[model samples]
Target chain A: MTDKTPHDWLNEHGDYLYRFALARLRDTHLAEDAVQETLLAAIKSPSFEGKSAPRTWLTGILKHKIIDIIRKQGVEQPAEDMSQYAAEEDPADEFFNERGHWADRPLAWPAAENALEQKQFLSVLQRCIERLPPKLARLFLLREVHEEDNESICKELQISPTNAWVMLYRARMGLRQCLELHWLGK
Target chain B: MLSCKQASELLSQSLDRPLTRRERWALRLHLWICAACRRFGRQLMLIRLAVGKVVAETEQNENLRLSPEARLRMTRALESGQ
Candidate 1:
């Protein structure tokens, strides 16, 4: 319960913290600012009793800081346009095709593996990922690319363990289907 | 004893290695009879392996080519008074 306790927390956790912020914010300056504000707020809290790990505690503060930053930046979606990302496809049509299959019989694993080896495939993949919704894209980037664990991913995404699993599933499915349409010559 | 929905849930759960023995059994039984689930599993496998490979290549190239200034900044923040 010392005044400088949060300083120590930041010092210990800043790398993890910065990466978290940068990945979410996609801007170095903003992430740096978020980390600074998080440190300031965490130090002043009576709740900084170290009940949880310092990393977890600091990340919790950063999460809210991110939300506030996003809000102040007027990142809200128009209510009418909100469903654009949410309205992907008719689930019945997607999961169950007219011919009664997953609809797109995906190419072989090695075909995609070969795609991975090529520079052009990567360019294509990046383009597709950029088009992903922020939440879903972040989740996909973390879980699939960054190799984050289910527990860490769930906490970061602020979802139920089950919901995290579901979201991760969708992220994988969406990214693949999108990339397939874009690159795999479906 | 698992329903089709539960069996479907087990499909991903099994992939994650967190399924109970009973759930695993139910999923296996379902996949044995349901070509749909089998195809679904293949899709998941292909997608995962493909994505994993893509991640490896991109990760190698991305951090390697970070602008020197951005690299300096991240490095400095990491080393500062910690």
Candidate 2:
């Protein structure tokens, strides 16, 4: 099999690469730059041995670029003030009663597997993720999207392990409510 | 008996870390009696599965893309680098 030229790579995989980066970086310029950088590196390296699909190979490179940028941002940006997060009201209070029982008990989501296959459901999920508080969203993405472990995430966000767990719990709780309200309940 | 709030929090934390024997037993006991908490646990798992699916299939999503100008700029950069 012959190798495709750089233009061919761009034409075929450009948007996919851009979307992947944007999901992680959430900054348009950074996402675009990451896609470009990945393509350039792919062009320079002779590492494509045709074991995986072109898109998969490109994504591998893009993942590293994203991680590097996140690391840099961790250093450049001030540490997150986690005290404010700690002081924030428990999200569970909205769903639980004074007795700590579920006020609005969770209903079983019918056909949840089918919802995953639908494009509309996916978009709703994306919007819910975007609605998450910025720090919570970052922690969620680092764990769910980037597949980073809790230790590294704590280090990257300058949050303690306990705080990371609390933040992640908040993020999941928020996302669950948003999904139920917007998609499942409808 | 674990309250619904504590049980649910333990359920969420189980996704990130292993629960101790006592915590696991308490959660199990609560889930056995609490239908709502059981549903909550399943829904949390579904949310995680949905997020993974979104990441896996992002390439097929037409709503998200690089703008034309950015694409053009990247193309130029690639050409120059070549």
Candidate 3:
């Protein structure tokens, strides 16, 4: 690795690391702190011989930093009233009729296996996630992205098993509606 | 007869935890007859896949750069570590 100064690392990889951190951490200040920690770690490590892309190396460090924070913090109590997101109650009723049948069937999506590779689709998905209420969004990510099980999520969030299930279900339902509108509708 | 709502909840739950025999049977029956619920289940899986991809690709993305102020703060922190 070239003897690049800290400024060089910042200029080259700071923002990318920040976005990566922010996407998972979901807190602006914490994201900044994680990026700061990543940069500091990079400086200490002597073996970053440019074997991989600079951004890739920095991201690897940032992933660890984010995990460290999540571990140290344990379960973060939702910073706000989670009930507001939950208070609306599940709109499960709308999907069914009096006899508990599909009042409105879910619209069919094109069988595009490559949709996941499309940048636009991801961008739309990102927007949909961002639009979710914070606690719900975090729970969704923890479950789907982090692969945390229901018990751990319930334990960490200090919610009951039922609450955890409801929140996750709502998040999926919400994401489905959002994608139907933004990505598929496009 | 599980409502689409019930089936949807069960479907989402199955991703997190193992479904019971009753749930599995109920969901299978519901999906077999309800095309809309079936579509929802498929779309839910697609969304999960897409999110995983987005999260993975974000790590290596270069299009987004840090702001000047933040870059400076992060840089100083690293230099101070040295």
Candidate 4:
């Protein structure tokens, strides 16, 4: 019980710690609040033993805070609809593509990594991404994009392994067609 | 005589790579003559490529952030707690 715990280390590393939380939570007030809670919990439990980088320790706390923020936001911005992103509230079908393929023809582009460097590239991708269903976008973000494995994505997205596969398939299909149309201009 | 769903399921596999030799022959034969399936295959390929690009783009941006403020806030919280 001789450990300094989270609160004891705070005065020495306050600004540094807040920076970590702010990066994830994206709000000044919330970041402050999350740190406050993490400190209170660490002091009460006395489990914040001295070991790894204190910054890392705080970051772990902030990560939980970030997750809380995301969950409280009620829903991750459903990846499907760009319109919804603007309005921030919209009811839409999970899989609304009636067609057998992507709505937009794929746009030819420089390699994706190359395309990302340019701001204009995202614009061409807008419609095609909009075509993806919410779950599909989330899956795409988690899987191919994030390099997350099937198990982790399924757990976070609350989807079955089978559904995860389908969403990925759908995501790929949607993006491919959209890119082709843009790139080929057909 | 695969149903629409069955054919669709196989479509994903085909894009990754053609199905088994026997299945490929059947599918290839079907795609050769069937305009609808051919278009469908084309659509799927296009979609696949587009997603591949977008996914790459998303990852590159994933860890990036506007700045590092959380750590400072966490430190403040700790100070307050004491």
Report the poorest 10 consecutive residues by lDDT, candidate 3 chain A.
A76-85
Worst 10-residue lDDT window, candidate 4 chain A = A88-97
Measured over the true interface residues after superposition, the C-alpha RMSD of each candidate is 6.6, 2.9, 3.0, 7.8
Q: Name every residue pair that clashes in candidate 3.
A: A15-B66
Give a tens-digit lDDT track for model 4, residues A37-148.
6566656555466546766666566555544544454333334444543363322122223433322322334554565555555556655665665434534543543334
**Which TM-score value belongs to model 4?**
0.43
Query: Against the hidden reference, what TM-scores do the models get?
Result: 0.54, 0.77, 0.72, 0.43
Best by TM-score: 2
The candidate, 1 or 2, that scores higher on DockQ is 2
- lDDT tens digits, residue span B1-82, model 3: 8877788889888887889998899899988998888888888889888878777776566665566777667666766788
Docking category of candidate 2: medium
Residue range with the least summed lDDT across 10 consecutive positions in model 2 chain A? A75-84
Which is the winner by TM-score between candidate 2 and candidate 4? 2
Candidate 1 ranges with C-alpha deviation above 4 Å? A1-93, A97-115, A118-120, A145-148, B1-9, B15-17, B34-36, B62-82
Model 4 misplaced regions, further than 4 Å: A1-36, A39-47, A76-99, A119-150, A153-186, B1-82
Docking class of 4: incorrect
> What DockQ does each prediction reach against the true complex?
0.18, 0.62, 0.61, 0.18
Candidate achieving higher TM-score, 1 or 2:
2
Model 3 residue B20 CA deviation (Å) reads 2.0
